[model samples]
Target: MAKKKSDGVNKSQAIRDYYAANPKAKPMEVAEAMKAQGINVTAQFVSTVKSNSKKSKTTRGRASAKKSVAKKPAKRATRASKATSEVSLDSLLNAKKLVEEMGGVEGARNALSVLEQLMD
Candidate 1:
């Protein structure tokens, strides 16, 4: 078996570089330029590289959006923690007494739900 020739050249990078320098260049033009530079590539391969680069950029945009959304949850959690810290122990004890009077936590929640509906 014969080993495939390895010229140590990255054809995809070369194609991408050529396209970056010549943004309006066609796929065939990029292929021809790479062939001149000793990296044999087809126009189809160049087109594939361009399409893959565009997809990667779009995916990066979505990844950044997801990161921003993830940060929002952290901020909300911090605000919730601050709000919880602001609740006095007396208020918590009173709420506990109220829950016991209502018979249990579930009964208190049901009474609150009814109160909420009446308020609406």
Candidate 2:
């Protein structure tokens, strides 16, 4: 077991290095290897350390120089027009029921015409 300095920072680096060296090694195996070298760590701890190392590495160089872009809001009528192109199964069933209640297909068409006028 190698003696750590005043702070225990090297343990995390050692764990990360072990993961790099044996990418397929299980968490328990990593813990046991650390145990052999006189550092006590759990499998969960190993997983946490590994994940944090990955996160830190990914975020290190990307935060400062990035620019935030303001996006414009989309037009509601355009979105609604796009939405009307596809009819879902539930909507079809409801339309069928409404047509039956109105006494037939012609009644449904008349109802739809009134609804379209109301929307405008």
lDDT of 2 by residue, 2-94 (tens): 965775547788899999999888889999999898888899999998888777453465353223444344323322245467766656666
Give candidate 1 misplaced runs (Cα > 4 Å): 1-6, 57-120
lDDT of 1 by residue, 3-104 (tens): 866878877788778878999999999988888877888999999999887774544632444334332211112222554558655557667766865878
User: How high is the CA lDDT of each candidate model?
Assistant: 0.75, 0.76
lDDT of 1 at 85: 52
Estimated TM-score per prediction?
Answer: 0.44, 0.45
**Which consecutive 10 residues in model 1 have the weakest lDDT in total?**
71-80
